[model samples]
Structure formats: C-alpha cells, structure tokens
Target: MVVHSKFQSDTVLSYSGSIPYTCYEIGHTWEPGCVKTFFQTFCDAFKFSIRVYTVFYLATFVIKLRKKENRRIKKIKKLLRDILQSSIFLSANGAFFMGGFCMLRNLIGKFYGWHGLLAGFITGILSIQLERKSRRGMLALYLMNLAAETLFNMAVARNLIKPIPYGEVIIFSIASAGFMSLFRQRNGLPENLHSPLTLIVGPEESRDFYRNGGNFSQRWRLISCLPYLQKLLQRLKTVHRSHQSCPHNNSCTYYTLEGIFKQFLLGYGIQILLNALQSLRGKQKWSKVFNNISLASFLAGFIGLFRACNCSLRWLLDRDIPALHGALSGAVAGTTLYFYRSTSIALYFFFKLMEVLYFRGIREGYVPHLPSADQYLYASTLAIILHASCCEPHNIRPGYWKFLCGVSGWKFPVMFRKLFDVFGTKATTLYPNFVPDLDPRYVKTTAVMELLKVHGKWRDPTNF
Candidate 1:
C-alpha cells in the first residue's frame, strides 16, 4: 500500500485547544531555531550513539578487520567516520522529529496523532539519505519488527484481537521453514549476503559457494578451536556414505556435531560476556551464573537438531523433496525455542522471512515493488515511538522509552505533557510521575519522588 503522508487522516478526532510547542510536549527543550536545535540534538545524540554504534560495529572489526583496504591508522580513521555517519543518522532523525512537530503545529493549526506520523515520515525520507544505503533496508527491517509488535499489543489492549500462546515461536518456525525451503530451492538467500544457516548446514547448500567461500559463510571457520577435540574430529572420517542429494561433506553426524559445538561455544561466550557486564552494575547473581547454560544449549540444539533432522529424513526417505524436507526440519529445529525463548529473536527472523518473501514476490511478478518502503517504515516506526513516548508512555517498551530519553538528552521528563491530556491518551494518569511543573493545566502539583513507580505507590499528577 502507498502510505502517503498528509494532515487529513481517519484518525483525527477532537481539535480542542492549541497544539503549539508551549501547549504540548514535543519531547525536546522548546528553544527557538530549528537549525540550532538540530545541532544541539546531534551532539547529544552523538555522545550516546557513538558508544552504541561503536559497540555494534565492533564485531565487524573482530570478524574481518584484517581485510580492509585502508592501512591500520587509516582504517581506524575511516571506521570512526563510518560510525559518525550512523550517529548522525540517529541524531538528525531525532532533531528533525522535533522540528517537524513544531512546523506541523504551526502549519496545520493543530496537532494530532497523525501529525507525528507525517513528521516522522517526512524526516525519514530526508534523513535516510544521510545513512549508508546498504544499511537503510536493515534499519527499516528492524523498525518494522518493533512496529509490528507494538501494533499487535495495541490491538490486544483494545480487545480488537485475541492473544495467542507461543505466537512468536510459531512465527519464527514458519519464517525459518520458509528460509530453509528457499535455501534448498537455491533461490532464497540474498545475493552476497552472509546467511547464518551457512554455518549450520554447510556451503554445499549455497548456490554461490565458490564466491562466498571465507566470506563469513563457511562452517569450518569457527570450529578450529580446542586442539584436543580438533584432533579427535580429524581422525573420525565419514561414518556414513553421503546420500546422492546430500549437500554436505563427511559423515552426517560429524557435520551436525561440528556446527553444534561451534555455535554452542559462540553462544556461551556471548552470554558470559553479557552476564559479566550485568555483574559490573553491582547486581551479580552469583547463584545462577554458572548454571546459566540455556543460551549455549539453545544454540547448540538449534543447529544440531536441524542438521540431524534434515539429514536423517533425507536418507530415510531415499529422495530429497527440498521444500518438504527443508521446511519440516526447520520447524523441528525451531522447537528448540523451549530451550531459550526470546520474542526479540523470533520477531527478527519473522521480518527476515517477510523480506525474503517480498523480494521473491517482486522477482516472480506477484508483488508490486515500492522503492521507498524502507524509508517510510523507519519513519513511521519512529513516529509511533515518539507519539507513544509522550502521549502513552505506558504502552511503549520500557527499554525503548529509555533509548528515546538518552537520544533526546533526557527531554521527555522536561516535556510539557498536561495539555497532552487533550488527546485523551491519559498520559498524566499512566505516567503519573512526570515533573510537577509540566502540567500546564495546573502548576505546583507535587511530582512523585520515587521516579520509577509502576502500580502500587505512584503519586498521581491529576490531583490539583
């Protein structure tokens, strides 16, 4: 669907009172000069975003820092610049959001929920240009994941839809199944993109095996650790002859186990580091740290089961129905979600499936291609987040709310929100601890001192 940004929408309701900067919270300091605000917002966002972007991009260096075209010093400089570009992308997006809200209030004569949408959408188009083109689709995809979940929760809250048990698992299973099916059909994985399944199932399953070798797609790269175990694996040759259609080398058991061990160690290492970081905050749960093997086992089980099921079913049936076997095995493997459940992981794969399907549709002439979908998705997602942050803080994911707080330089608490009650979102009621002076309707009301109250003991801001 073509999502055209406009002031008029079906969502419009009460137009009472002014929606100007002073009347409502725009989630920023209401200073003059959009240009100045943009730069100010940029610096604040950069301080936080650089640390985040650096951590995120850190793995790239660890994985392939040696293959860069630039020299050691130059590579570091270029990487810093690249990271800066992303920080700017995030900072500029927030600045533009504030600017857009202000502009919309003035031009439209009032503010509405859709105003956020319009502003977000416009800024998305403009700001996306500053981001690396390669990352645009990925950014859009991530936001789409968040948007999809937020909308689902909203629907459930409104009683528009019933919640399903293990819904995320179901979604992940289907998506993974679709992915495996496509991979087997030799037309699913994106060109030149590294797929995680390559390590699990091996490169023989890949269509561009020659081109993709050593490009983070090979199964052999990670399993070269543990010299003693390596010696043992080297001695054991293929125990079972390969089925004619088998896209793997050596015995099936060895191939399957190698992936399991590698992935297990990888997951364990990651979880340990995370646990250590959490420990640094003086909240060390020493009681459960050693026993926290769920992540490791889950990763191992994921690939172990997938390889075992696929190979066993293939050999037993004596024929490889690529789609059927691939899908069935994928579903079976996804059942390991019981080992470690994560809505975030499942949702990520679900959108990945959507991307695969959408692209496939375009190729097969079954779907209309939209060139600007990524930009729109990113913008709209941000719009939803900004709107909810002020008008319905209770509805947003707490972590995301904190993220907005960081990026906006702690502006939400200072934002004027009492006029926000005009929209009937119950902003004051839900987030009752906002600054006392924030409510334009009434001044000098005592703000809650606790700051982080949920249910039992929150000071209500509505009491005049």
Candidate 2:
C-alpha cells in the first residue's frame, strides 16, 4: 500500500475555483510554516485584545488614581511596566508549544506518523530547546512536558482512553493546566527566558506565599478580604486529588468524571445564552471586540476538533494520516469560517460566543448586564459545563462537509487587495480599535526575561 508520489503517477489532478474535494499534496495544506503563521497571527490578534482592553486599562486606572496618597508615582509606573510585559509574553506564547508541534508535524509528515508519536517525541525535545531560557526553568518545562508526553503515549499505546472521545485530552489539559509549565516564579515568568512572564495571579494566600516582605497593595488587600477564596481552592484541591487516581500505570491523565460532568453542564448553559445574544446584537465596537475573541476561540476549538478527526482517521484508515491534515484542517476551517460557508460556521459562532463570554472576553473589559463582581465565578461555572458538553462523542461529525458556499464575505476581497497593493497596507489598519500604544519599558523588561533564559541565567523557582 505505497502512496505514489505525483512524479510516479502520470495523472495530475489539480482543480481550482472552490471545488469540494480532498487534498493530497504534502506541502499544499499542512506545511509547517503555514500552520505556525495562522496561529501566530491568531496569538498576536488576541494579544492586542488582552493588552488594550484588560492590562492597559487596569494599569492606567491604577497609575492615575490620586486616592493612593502614600504610594509613589515611580513605583506605580514600574509596576505598570512589569504587569504589561508579563501579560504580553503569556498571551503570545501561552499555546506556543502545542501550536508549534502541530505545525511541525504537518511540515515533517515524512518523519512523523499519525499517532503523532514522532511529533510528541520531537515536541518533547524541541520544547526544552526553543523554550529553554534558564537552566532550572528549562528543566521544569522539560519535566512537565515529559509528563504530558508520557500520558499521550499511554493513551496511544494501551488505548487507555479509547473510544473516550478525542477532546478528552483537551478537557484534561484545561483542568490540570497539563499543557502549561508551572513553578514558583516571582511572577508568571518564562522558565527558559527572562524577558517575558505572566504575573502569577492567585488568591491572596497564594500571593502571600510568592511575595517578599510584609508590604502589600490596597487592591490586593481587598482581595484578601474575600474569605471564600481559600475555601474554594481547598475544594478544588480535593477534587484535584480525586482526579489523580493512578490506574496501576502512570502513563496517561484525563479529566475526572466530576470535573467533566460539572464543566459540560456549565459551559453548555453559557454557550446557549451567548448564542441567544448573537441573535439579538448587531456588530458594534464592543460587540466586534467580543466577536474577535469568539473568532479566536472558535479557531482554537476548530483546531482541537481537527486534531481529533485526524487522530480518529489515522485509527480507522490503518494508515498514518499526514500532518497536512492538521494544516489543511486549519486552513480549511479558517478559510471556510472566514468566508462564512461551512456548516461548522454555526458551531463556530456558537462556541466562539461561549469562549468570549466564559474564558477571555469579559476579562478584557466586557461587562455583562449584571453588575456583580463575581462574574469570574459564573464564567468558571460556564467554562466547565461547555468543555464537557463539547467533549460528548455525539457532537462530532468529521467527514460530512458537503453543505458549504464556495465564497461569501469580505475577507477574500480584503486579502486580494493586500496581495495586489504596491504599497503595503498598514499593519495596524485592520484592528484599529485594539492597537496598543506600548511603552519601551514593557518590551525591555520582557526582553531581559527571555535573554536570561537564552543566556542561562534562569533557575527554576520550584526547584529551590
């Protein structure tokens, strides 16, 4: 069952003008660079949203307040710089390795197989290299990644989670932060480099554990007043422990039945409400901003779905599915959704609405009709439910993609306009509302953090 290269096959099949069919060319759809480029674009887009709406606004409010008479302006300024730098790095590279390896698998289909066994191995190794900025931090990232790889291998090798639905891994991932590297850092700093880090956000007790000296901020002081934070975390801990059951072998990890059930109910309920909202509101500035968040989340979710489809296809065909499936899936999904053609478009809109409402949008200055500050609690509840509902085996229909319009929407025209322009379109022109007028301090501090990792100055805070 050898796959004949086009060179060997005299018949060349090439069609254009939006014919619905399958693609076989290796680099045509799944080229590694193509995969990376789309995700990079996605990350940058979302990064703007995070900065302009959330970090920038909050930082300005904190810096401008005349009420804090005791605090010096210089200190406020420094804190602002630090917070923005850390957030940018996290948003930019938060999903870097997952997205990177997915890209690489597509690009190097010759080397990697359907199970992504090679991709996982390569991902495990490369994560240590590209992401390594500090020795200790690198080590920690390596260990956490190793744990992830081991779990993936177990799932493949023993079929430990077989017929368990492909998205179960994602559920486990979100619940445990399995794809993320975690350790004790001064902030959510990159373990491998010094230039960028997310400011570690937690309950006041957790903050107390990380902070030096007795000094604290007024805002944080208010956070400490909430007595329920620790109680909630303790409950989470108990649930986490229950999910940690070892099934004789330590090869794979998955969501707890409780976590899965809880998340599905809540997330689905939120999604329903969001979908209802989409029916009512036309695109406005705030709505557009929220829509972008929805769009990005939709893209991410589609990627997850495509990955599952490819894995399942590999299993069914008894042949290694090409990485191009990953690339092709992304391109197809994006092109399809952007053009408003595919049936999945409906799913995309619904899920995207859910994503913005529950996970990211509200954090970035979106306020609901409700005035309660306990929005996060509700969002969290929604996230859990939607995650579970989306994971249901019945929700997926991978092969059926017939109902699609070949073209619609302005995206294609806009792309063509850029392609033909002698003078390039301004980079910031597309997302005018979200562009950040960033300071040099944020860049400098983030660069320093990454430099430390690349230069070998970083040590894992957890190790100490």
User: Highest lDDT: which candidate?
Assistant: 1
Off by over 4 Å in 1: 1-40, 72-74, 191-195, 204-244, 248-255, 422-424, 428-430, 436-464
lDDT of 2 by residue, 1-464 (tens): 11223222324222111111111112112222445544654455345434443655466666567567527778667656655544443333223323443455345432112212233333334333332243323233223332333344334543556543433333332321211112112232223321211121112111114333334223235434677954543354344221122211111111122222333344455555665566567523333333323333343343334333333444456543233333333333333233222333333333322333443344655654444323332223222221111111112132210100001011111121111111111212332222122222222233223433443544454454
RMSD of 2: 24.6
Candidate that would win on TM-score:
1
TM-score of each: 0.78, 0.23
Backbone clashes, each candidate: 0, 25
Cα displacement (Å) at residue 319, model 1: 0.9
* lDDT values for all models: 0.67, 0.31
Candidate 1 deviation (Cα RMSD): 7.9
